[model samples]
Target: MAHSHDSTALDLPLPARRHQTLALVLVRRLAGHGLHDARATMLALDAGGTEFRRLLVLARALVVDLARTSRRRILLAPCCAAGMTRDEGLLMAMIGGGGLDVHGVLTDDAGCAIAMTTAHALGDELERLATRNDWRR
Candidate 1:
């Protein structure tokens, strides 16, 4: 959705509404972590040239949430999380939504560790799919 400088909330397109909601979720979470500049961040994000551009900005901003070491809450960065691919982010959201604890992994040992989504049916499905996919690069 393209927002004109004069457009009001009621005039926003459907896709823009979704983008705004996702961005707000991240900004609100950031505020809880004592970020006073969240409103400013939101405004800047809204100024992005395109919808995908805005999403990318929001995703990168939420990466800060992923960096925080917390055991009480799970934070997601849309289609982009630190060291995570789009598929990984979607998988994490699916599994994480199942009332399970999830977190981003920062390990120097594996050299492959990234986000940690809970293991369940979704995880099993992902595993099966990955096994059949031999073109990993």
Candidate 2:
């Protein structure tokens, strides 16, 4: 006798699936909020324009709860007056001395590196939080 084989699979864990669904919902909400498309948003941000700055600000704001829960420290660099810098400054200030550190730099390149470093540090904290079962499900 011959047997037929099927190769389709869905391998996500329950909590992970729920988290992914929540993320998708958030993405849809972002798109509805004038982010256009996710790919377009990524391109725009990579291109570094006013829209990019706005999108970054929105993205950062959306992740504030996660940052707080993770006890992440963010160092913000000031580059423009178009609101992103202002908003990040406000966020860092709100986090106070222990939680986040805000630094203003002269060039966009320096600012980008600082932001990247902050993100890296935050990622480590988030990982630790996850390992310790401190992350919200």
Best by TM-score: 1
Give a tens-digit lDDT track for model 2, residues 50-134: 4345434444443443333332233232221122233243333332222233322212222233343443443333343344443
Q: lDDT, candidate 1, residue 28?
A: 38
Q: What lDDT score belongs to each candidate, Candidate 1 first?
A: 0.34, 0.34
lDDT of 2: 0.34
TM-scores of all candidate predictions against the true structure: 0.23, 0.22
Total clashing pairs for each candidate: 0, 0
Count of clashes in candidate 1: 0
Candidate 1: 10-residue stretch with minimal lDDT: 6-15
In model 1, which regions exceed 4 Å deviation? 1-49, 70-91, 94-100, 103-137
